[model samples]
Target: LEIQKKGNEWAVVLDSKYNRRIDANTKMEVSGAAKKEVLKDKKFAYGTFANCANGQTPWGTYISCEENFDDYFGSSDENLKFDENFKRYGFKTKSEYGWEKFDERFDLAKNLDEANRFGWIVEINPFDAKSTPIKKTALGRFKHENAEFIVEKDGLVIVYMGDDEIDEFIYKFVSKHKYVKGGDTSKILDEGTLYVGQFNGNVGDFRGSGKWIALEYGKNGLDESKGFKSQADILINTRLAA
Candidate 1:
């Protein structure tokens, strides 16, 4: 469910019996591991700038991508950093919409290091608004332009995702688990494989088809030689991952 506030506190109309008020400093329980340890206490996870998108999952969750995080994190005077990959892929370290300097947290933006906490396809159980949004790294990363789902003739599930940049690659995640008639959406999303696309051709050759490779685990991982990796890495450094 999409919720927002004009200034100060915003109320979450959870149900006919439960109407809760959440503010910039509202304590909440967000799902994530700090240095890999599971935290159970509820802490504040939202504030004034909670703009999200309009995409729903088959399992029934809302995905919110963190675009322009630099805006809330504050702006940086230090030149944006780029590597060979950036040059090969035609990306600029410099950004026109500078906002990283205003707030250091938005630099990711607050416990906004938690903002990397976001990025992965976030799963929000709109049916249960109090449910913590789960970032599905299994979805890979990039700008996460969009997630499109289509069922195959044989009843398989297929998802198409675009990176939304000049030369960024495309991605597709085929679930290891099939969609069931009455399955839990959160469980289905939490478990799946992620992949990234690799196109081979000369600078001007854009007419041929490309290949989709799994950024799988262990033997089938994404590396410098083959490209791509765990969904977490892909989600955190999506631009570079592509």
Candidate 2:
């Protein structure tokens, strides 16, 4: 939807692409991952649900977050084994919305990997109504609350986002490239490192500073031994990696 400011009045109206189905293209280039891992070749998904809160990018695009997405999916067959990853993400034999009963895509028994497709921040272009919504996988996937944009003095960006679950986690994505007005801002969200927030100093105390630990794949024991096969794996299983 677009909110336009007139002389003395503000007009809020539905956009041309309002209530549109999300494009299922996974444009991110994740290499050598299993075809059955998430979406086939980590390449596609159906649609978005539970989009609770949103934010805007410095480049003026809409950031829609998926929250409580696990509620849409469930296992029709309880005999189907669920892994630790599934438990961490809060998938279950039965979901709150029971969408699995109607949509096979929501059934974990049928499409287990489909769960991984959700829970990431989806970016939509306001300028191009026909634009495909890009899932920013560089930002770790979770039950996202909202992304707060922080523009560095030098034009780089730091995106702060919370997991939106009790005692979950907070993360920040720092961009490697700088943002230039009217210049290309593609890499600002695509190429970045994610860091989980670390709180220091406490014990019934109220105020303190917090440190950030990078959730990079090869750093601090996040290797194949721990089941992190690639950067995409780290991004998919962010909570466990953290």
Candidate 3:
């Protein structure tokens, strides 16, 4: 339904009305690009290659995550090959789908920088295919399997996500704003904080409910020196930032 690229910035295939592409020059406009002009770079999706693993959002939008990216491009080492990170999901180092052969951008080695943009949760509004899809980096950049939503009693937002690879972490993003019930989906989603979880408990903790900790920005023991410059920065490099 929707497609996207992840990196320090985010990009989406604008609905058919505003659809755009990111060549060697364009940057993406994912969530959290308020400052530093990180969203200026726009390399939109080429017609050739497309990513997968999509689900529908409550707001009539589609969420898609890119998996098994190494196969798209030529990787010099096996480390870059589909590592354990990709295994948790349903991907192998060798891609059965030969999209790369059709598009040069599909090749990871040729577009090494692009590789950083994959493995993210992309948001698409099928109703408006003209609008560009966006990569919500606040969700972290990994082999994402799902982005399911569960609203709390107070109308706060909570998105549950799985890494899909072995030993990968499950994460959630609790919104700072309450759900409008019928508000503009696109506008509301742009504002929220991303968080990762670490299930902790002794023998009992493992079996019972796992505590949910908010991966605060520069709080709860995050480095201040090389810390996230803005919410955009946090969303941009969520994987590395965590």
Candidate 4:
């Protein structure tokens, strides 16, 4: 979808050539931290279309979020084992969308890894029609509400995001590299430090200082001892790490 301004008015037009409507069946590539060893060659997965909120980058790209994605997958009564991360991310025994009725990928009982593929912040380049959207797993996955970025004076980007569910945490991603004008900002999200907020002080007093806890693997007991194999594992199960 593109918004174009004519001589006197602005109009929203569907540029089918450049505009893409990703559905449940669409396939995408997984990148960032999730591309590590355990998920190396398994970087491809089905689409993510339950976009609730979106954000844009300074380089003019779209960030599509997947919210309430768990409702699209169905469960089974065969006592199938579910990924512990699934329970933390709120996978139900029954699907609201019932997408599993048609596609077996939506059935967690059948494809356990399918559910892990969604709930990510996907980046789409509206300018390039041939470009495939990237699933930025380094930003951490959850019920992503929105992803807003603030570029500092030195060109370092700080991305602020939130988990929409009640009592959920707020997150921020700081790019490891500084942004350069006229340079490629597409891969900036691929490598970054993800942090979760922890508020202190009384509830009614808006005068509390908060801390941004780093979610990096091997830091603060986020290593294999805690069942986190790599940075990708921590990001995929961000809710549990938070």
Best by lDDT: 4
Model 1 CA deviation exceeding 4 Å by range: 1-53, 75-103, 107-115, 152-156, 200-207, 217-231
Give lDDT tens digits, candidate 3, residues 132-177. 6676666666667767887789877778887665666788877777
Give the Å error, residue 96, model 1: 6.9
Off-target runs (Cα >4 Å) in candidate 2 are 3-37, 41-43, 203-206
Question: Model 4 segments beyond 4 Å from truth?
Answer: 7-9, 13-17, 36-43, 203-205
Worst 10 residues of 2 by lDDT: 26-35
**Residue-by-residue lDDT tens digits, candidate 4, 1-242:** 77789999988776557766676666677788776532444757767777889999888889998989999988664466566788887887688887877788788887777777888898888887777777889898899999998999999999999999999999999999889989977678988899999988765666667799999999988988889988888988999899
List model 2 lDDT by residue over 74-155, tens digit each: 9889777788788888888989998889878789998887888888888887676566776777888899999999889999
Q: Candidates' TM-scores?
A: 0.61, 0.87, 0.65, 0.91
**TM value for model 2:** 0.87
User: Clashes in model 4: which pairs?
Assistant: none
Pull out the clashing pairs in model 2.
Answer: none
* Candidates sorted on lDDT, descending: 4, 2, 3, 1
lDDT of 1 at 141: 38
- As a TM-score, model 1 comes out at 0.61
Q: Candidate 2: deviation at residue 174, Å? A: 0.3
lDDT of 4 at 79: 69
